[model samples]
Target chain A: MQGMSPIVKNMTRLVAGFIVLFGVYIVLYGHMTPGGGFAGGVILAGGLALVVLAFGEEFARKALTHEAAKTADSIGAMLFLLIALLGYAGGVFFTNLLPVGEVGKLFSAGIIAPCNIAIGIKVGAGLFGVFVALAVFRRAGAGSSTGMIEG
Target chain B: MDPVLLLLLVLLGFMLAGSLIAVETRDLLSSVICVGAVGFGTSLVFLLLGAPDLALTQVVVEILVLVVLVRVVITRRDETHATSRATLPVGLVLLALGVMAAIVFGTLATGEDEGLTMRPFGDPLLNEQAEASVMAPAGEKAPEGAPARMPKSAGGAFLAHGLSESQGSRGTGAANYVMGILLDYRAYDTLGEATVVFVAVLGVYAVLRKVGRSRHAGNESDR
Candidate 1:
């Protein structure tokens, strides 16, 4: 936790930026690539984790919190599930409620990509929330009566 | 047996094994990990079967479930090992029975459903006439008994025709079409699913929010 040099900090920042960008790329090109919401979300979370690791947990918590992230994550998940359920009222479960556009085009896959984006946001935020909450409870002396024991 | 069928069986075996481990493992973390492995295997099988959409959905759901489970595990008071049931012999027999039943049902179902085939006759005169009616730019009445290449709705007729051609040309619609059918033809079902998600999020929020409020109250009293 000590002696983190300036060069190491800069390198970490650069890698984090790349990881976040790559995650975005994967989510956007989900229809054509092996990477989609899950892969992209984790990649995005990894970027956030790098920042927390290099800078500090306090800084990360300030940027993203469990309370706020929890809301957005819920919204994203709700939207996807809602879309799936809409199919049932139409006489089937998980039916497409919207018209399918030209295949292979960016807007062609109906709501699939939008659903993917929602999932990506939910997952990224959820993972970050987990890590930050743990850090706060354990290292930040924020949760529980068993405070840090000074050796 | 077809190579694809054989491969599917192997994958299913792997999934069953992982799920059994997940259920039988005493350690919570290991069980979670095993459950994730099962999800990953199922997703892979979906991908192989040309259902990329389902695969994507499965993977995303798995990640979400895992994240929630991990969070709960982290917050819980008890971090010790859980008890594993001591019925290995019974478990194996049940597993075998389940697997056999699944395979038998799957094969029987597949055999029962013969896919859509072209009509007995070649393209009827109605089809040709319908094609002409479709090609007619605008302000045209299609002849009687025409194949009705396009829908009656002028606004969406062109779009519908284009969609059918694109989707029917290749068999790729198994995935893409599912999404279309899910949202459009079954909008109501989607509403329920969304509600479930909303409810789940609300439940999680309520718990986490309560935790925060109690902690905040505790801090105030300490002050």
Candidate 2:
């Protein structure tokens, strides 16, 4: 696919970065704010989807390669599990292993922040990968009659 | 009712109308757009209900779903011949709708004293705890004008300790109660949820691309 008109491309250029930034902000501040890993990760994926829609599949693959996304997806899930396992040093599983300081500050929430980051990475990369797999795998113009729609 | 409740009802009505249109529309693109409108309407309801996190997530998710649905419907024409509407599904749906409406209105009509009352929203037990804590006896070292002291608490995160006036000292220490519950008190549940998502994405990847069994000998050549 050649993507949409120049208007869409320009608009995506201006807006997509902010959307990603906002997602990061939400993920990082998850402990202190309303949004956490799940919501912020979805936002990040949505931003990438916007980029892909405006700039075509090739640009999206370049922006976040299929291989890299797959790797990130695995790493995020493993990191989260590793964090949980680290809690074994304490009495129980999923314990707050890191020392928690006074709340409302960035560094005070102990392992929660790290867990949020891990989940964010996993979800964002996994969803973007899902989008790419779904939309871009088919050969261009071959979708009319011999499409994967019935597949 | 209050102005907020009235506004919420109106917004809900709009959302219901949008969903009906989405379901009834013949054109695929218009149906998808109507679905988007209903989703945005639900997002607005979330915002009005003082849940900004849900609103934010809903808005972004709605956008992504809209993008995906619109792109697929637009690019891939559905060549399958349209069949006549089956009566069984229509009857079943209407039956389900009728039962749900009856249950909802019945519960609403039930007084506040009854079980399953809709009046109490979000952690009804916590509400009771809050009410009980208001009459709490002061601790031994209580200072004058100190806020309501909480009783001795159990292991759960909802027991927001009333010991100190400090912001972070609230039980579980994290500022947001939802975060505290999600990460500190019930972190394992979060882990389980993450696992579900992980497995689901993996399933999608596997299902979307299948040439041969993945682990079969010499299957690497498919790449």
Candidate 3:
């Protein structure tokens, strides 16, 4: 796929970093914030998507390949499940093992913060991978022969 | 006659109109934009109703959906024949809306038994006295089989104890009760939901692999 207009590219460059940073902020402070892992992860995916749309598919593949995204997705899921299974040490399936620190602090909310990070990573990577895969693969496959508009 | 209710109704009407326009519009691009309008309206309603988390999710998801849909439409030319029963979908949508409306009204309707009906929007059903007993500290577990000293409803209990320094055998210590509920109280549900996302992405990659697409060219259009 071809890159978008210079106007769009410039705008994306200006805005993408903030989007990613905000997403990370939301994920990290999910226990205290209104938006949590899922929402922040989607925002992260949107940031990556903005970059991809502005720069084109080849750029996306180079910066973050399908393999990398898949790996991140797997790691996130595994990390979340591992956090849950580790609760076995507490004699329950999903017990909160870590000490629930003082309220209103960043380190408070045992298992929640880490779980948020894991979920954020999984959701962001998975959605980005899907978007890249669906859009990029089709463009590469049906070039010229399909007689369709290749925009 | 409350102003907040009036505002909520206005937003709901706006969303309904946008969705109707989206469904009725013949042009795909207009339809997509109208759907986005509806989504934005829903997000606004969520914000108005005091659920910022839902509002955040709705807004970002709506944008992503709009981007994906527009990308798909602009990339590919329309080649499929128009459906014969076009109004059938419109009819089904209206029917579903009617059913949903009925369910909403029915759930809100106050019957002979007060326990059955859903409480009004602003006026919650939590007993004021439940607040006094929810101050138990960490390492203290409620006795087995006995009702935990909490508010009547499950959600009420979470609201009372979710942010508390101690929450049954362990201290949840969550500033955001919603986070406590999602991650600590209902972690299994979150796990299943994550798994669903993982599988969906996997399915998309598997179906759209380079080798399979190259081998069976034009097979995509068949679907």
Best by TM-score: 3
Residues A1-151 of candidate 1: C-alpha lDDT, one tens digit per residue: 2214688688987788887898887666664455655567766766775666567656655675666767777676776666566667766665444555545666546555676676677666666665555444344444543332111
- Which regions in candidate 2 have their CA more than 4 angstroms from the true location? A140-149, B87-157, B162-171, B210-223
TM-score winner, 1 or 3: 3
Note the DockQ of each predicted structure. 0.16, 0.48, 0.59
lDDT of 2 by residue, A23-92 (tens): 9998999989889888899899999888888888788667666778889999999999999999999988
Ranking by TM-score: 3, 2, 1
Q: Is the docking of candidate 1 incorrect, acceptable, medium or high quality?
A: incorrect
Mark the regions of model 3 whose C-alpha exceeds 4 Å error after superposition: A143-151, B79-81, B84-152, B162-165, B168-170, B217-223
TM-score of model 2 (CA atoms): 0.81
Q: How accurate is candidate 3 locally (lDDT)?
A: 0.80
Q: After superposition, how far is residue B158 of candidate 2 from its true place, in Å?
A: 1.3
Q: Taking the tens digit of each residue's C-alpha lDDT, what string does model 3 give over A125-149? A: 9998988876787666654434322
TM-score to native of every candidate shown = 0.55, 0.81, 0.82
lDDT score for residue B89 of model 2: 81
Q: In model 2, state the lDDT of residue B64.
A: 81
Give the CA lDDT, 0 to 100, for residue B115 in model 3.
73
lDDT of 3 by residue, B1-223 (tens): 6788778767877988999898777778888899999999988988887789899999998999899998887765774454666355878989998998876676446554767566554433444335324533346543333344566554754454443435632367777777887898889998999989999998888777776444345566568
